[model samples]
Target chain A: MTTSREIRLKSRPVGLPQASNFELATVDLPAPGPDEVQVRNLWMSVDPYMRGRMYDRPSYVPPFQLGQALQGGAVGEVVASNDPDFKPGDIVSSMFGWREYYNASPKALAAGGLGAITKLDTHGIPPQAFLGVVGMPGLTAYVGLLRIAALKDGDVVFVSAAAGAVGSVVCQIAKLKGHTVIGSAGGPEKVAFLKSIGVDHVIDYKATPDVVAELAKVAPKGIDVYFENVGGVHLEAAINSARPFARFALCGMISQYNETGKPEGPPNIIQAVGKSLRLEGFIVSNHVDMFPQFAKDMAEWIKAGKITWKETVEEGVERAPDAFVKLFTGENLGKMLVKLA
Target chain B: MTTSREIRLKSRPVGLPQASNFELATVDLPAPGPDEVQVRNLWMSVDPYMRGRMYDRPSYVPPFQLGQALQGGAVGEVVASNDPDFKPGDIVSSMFGWREYYNASPKALAAGGLGAITKLDTHGIPPQAFLGVVGMPGLTAYVGLLRIAALKDGDVVFVSAAAGAVGSVVCQIAKLKGHTVIGSAGGPEKVAFLKSIGVDHVIDYKATPDVVAELAKVAPKGIDVYFENVGGVHLEAAINSARPFARFALCGMISQYNETGKPEGPPNIIQAVGKSLRLEGFIVSNHVDMFPQFAKDMAEWIKAGKITWKETVEEGVERAPDAFVKLFTGENLGKMLVKLA
Candidate 1:
């Protein structure tokens, strides 16, 4: 038997979750059963969407149950294997995060199968890239801009949270596609990071009294596509600056996720009709069919040094909750992750 | 020479427009200039979208300027013609309404041409049918549902303002396409009109205290397509009861158009992310390509008794402003028009 440290939900969060809401518990792990392999988690992802799962309400994914170990995307290595498909030392990705180690079945690893468990082919790139740039975040950016927004050549693209995982990739992709990319970030540091990624215009929203005015100054003709990450003021700004027939891919609304009361939606949503705008909200899992193409393109981009990434990682499983809370506070410049042994 | 009685914008309205905001002016009109025809206005159409044009802000169509003649869809008789293409007694449609007479240039009559003037065949239907069932409002309903919403067979559709010009046609088309249709109207009279037109379920919003709860009770499976006409509470209710991957075609928001201050948007718009909903706003003028097919199909539908329309007409050009205001008050059941001699 082996010991595994895991984070369990102590209770549903009311607003911004407290560290006390999560309980660190140690559990005994037995040897893998038939067709199962034991995985030792190396790195786990902490995303804004996880905050929704902390609530007791229904969402695209099921809410995390109280007193149970929380689940998320994690990169791990097979420490022991009883399954022919997975051998010891093989690196894989799974939805078994918040735990130091767990047993995974091979049947669960198959495409469209049970739990998400796929073997990693790092190709000289770090395995954690599979958790951000070449993973769900990257695919989300690709699908949102190309598919949902129906981006075309010479399109003016505006992305909120542009230094973060998905927005960073979106900015880079739009630039590569010969489109003008405008990005918004919180502070001077993130604004500088966005400029490094080739964003045409970067707005430091924290410094700007009126983001809409700043956006209007940069995009005089107006934006064709808006990648909506931070909602509330960002949404209103985008709406005010959007050109006729503009498409907005509603990716995440991290701004209002922690609000206990119902947050007021964008007051100028009526502009949608006058401007003939399209706003679509989506969950990445529903568009998994595009993952293969996304993975191939992302790997090629990284290999050619056309793509760059950053990760704000906390050491040890005990700091997982801290990493997650930092996402809301805008403390992370890019993908927020927890490193585990 | 002719004396033409026209309505001009006296001032920009603050909330609901009053008679003081409009002026009745008598102007002396010259005979048709070269390549021009003098048209005597017969029937003028007043729609919900006209309210948007009343604002000074830019929209899909240019805002109606103060002290200028208000323009909209109008059908008239060519009283005199200098152009060979048009002759005396020729019935034509023009974008010069709220007036008794106007000089139309032949260059303005071509498809994809400026000024939007077209000769009418009538096809055994009333020429005013070109204004409602077979014209812009009809095409608005057709494109919004089939094109924007991308309605498919077996889908459940919920239409707000189900007894109004566009909404009435939308309900009928959805039913004819083998989809379940739910309709909402203000009064029992309008609610009965919805049932008469074969709507599967009808909600009298005026009678219901909680529209969301009432919608859930009727559409237990939830709606797949939502044709949004009224905004505010209706939009909130639709968002609450929308099924996963639902599409909303925002046609109008007559409810909030008269608000002096910013109206609160749908509080539950966050449900959009979880449900993967798409909300698209559109203008009928932007979709004129579908008019031919729409006109053809709509005429056939009406001829076969598969479709029907009602117009609440107020006699004389003097009642034009009254007809437009009646739209906001829900006094008109279907298409609101003013018959001008």
Candidate 2:
């Protein structure tokens, strides 16, 4: 038997979630049944998107249920297996996060899901990297940039939340493609990180009184592609700074995730008609067909030292809530992870 | 020599345009230059989009200059021609409206413009129809629906300004394509007009206090396509009623055009991320290439009695300012035009 410590939703958050809204609970796990594989989680991810699921509202993904263990992307090792597909010592990834151990049929876990349980071919990369770069987050950046935005040659790219997992990857990819990249993030650390990744211009949104003016100052000619992660002022700024026929990939509006009341949208959205802008929102799961190509490209990039990632780790399952809440508070620099084992 | 009476932009409008912002002036039209044609305007259009030119900001089209005649779509009869491409009494269309008569080179008038001078076939249709249904407004509806919105099978279309030129066409096209269409406009006349055009559902936005709630009440299943001509509450309503992967064709923001100060945008725009919505803005000028296809389809539709139009005409060039101002006050229905010579 294995004793798994998992976080459960104590209550729904009204605005910004607090750690008290979650509770750490212990569960005893039995031996794997027929066709089931037992896993012991090593790392788990906490993303801004998860905040939407906490609302108990209808969305692309189902809302997280109360009194149940919160689920997310997790990389783990097989402890034991009754399924031929998974053997002991094999590394796997699943949606069985916020917990230390789990037992489920491999087929059942793989059913119609982006976070399907599958044995990892790490290829010398860290297993936790699957939780951020080279995994869902990496594919998100790729699809949003190359597909949604339809990035073309000579396009000037702008990304919000530049130091976050997806934004950082977007910055590096656009820079690698020989395009001028402008990045916006909160503080000095994120600004430095963006600069380190060769971002042509960095705007510390926290320091800038008006993001619209700052973006205009940096991109006097205006941007051609916008990767929208942070909404509100960032969205307004993008609309203001966009050149004719600019494309915006609406990845996530992290800034609006915690709002208790309806958030005000970009006031200058009227400019879209005159500017011929296209803003398209997407869920990464819908573009899983691009995973193989994304993985191949990402592998080559990593091998050539063209890619890098950052992680802010919380060392235990109990700290998972803190890790998640930190995302809203801007306490994490890049990917926020819970080291579960 | 011919005498031409034209409306000039005496001053840029601060808010909703007033008669004082425009002035009627007279000029003597000299003989046609080497390649020029002399023409007298028969019917000139006063559209909502013309309001954008009154601002001194850079846009897809140049801003209207102070003391210069305002330009728009006009149908005219050739009085004289210097080029072999045209002859006397031939009906032509040009971007030389708000004036009774003018002389210009056909080459110069057609230079890099959608509002270029071209002889109209009329196809047994009326000359005034060239300023509306078979012209720029009709093409605007065609491109916005088929191209920008990328309408597919079973899309429930929601259009704001449903009684307006572009929107009325959008409603008819969607209905003809076998989709359920919900139209929103102000007053009883527009509601009756929408029903006459076979719109499945109609919401009188002026009578409906909460547009979002009204949309939900009308389209309980949510909408897959939104033809956005009005911004503000209509945008919010569309966002609220959007189904997953809904597409919005941002044609114009008539509601925001007359605002002297910054206007508040849709408060629920952040919902776009979760709904996987796509909002694309377009200018008909940019999609001029589709004119031939649109013309063919429109001719067929008109012949089969599948299409119809309404016009609110003001007599004489002196009433042009009143006609233009009526757009903001929602006094004009469908195509608003001024009858000249």
RMSD of each: 1.5, 1.0
| Candidate 2 C-alpha lDDT tens digits along A118-177 | 899999999999999998999999999999999999999999998998999999999999
Task: State the fnat of model 1.
Answer: 0.82
Best by lDDT: 2
DockQ of every predicted complex: 0.82, 0.89
DockQ of 2: 0.89
TM-score of 1: 0.98
Candidate 1 has a DockQ of: 0.82
| Residue range B187-286, candidate 1, lDDT tens digits | 9889988999899999999999999899999999899999999998889989999999999999989998998897888887878877889999998888
In candidate 2, position B226 carries an lDDT of 97
Q: Is the docking of candidate 2 incorrect, acceptable, medium or high quality?
A: high
The whole-model lDDT of each prediction reads: 0.90, 0.93
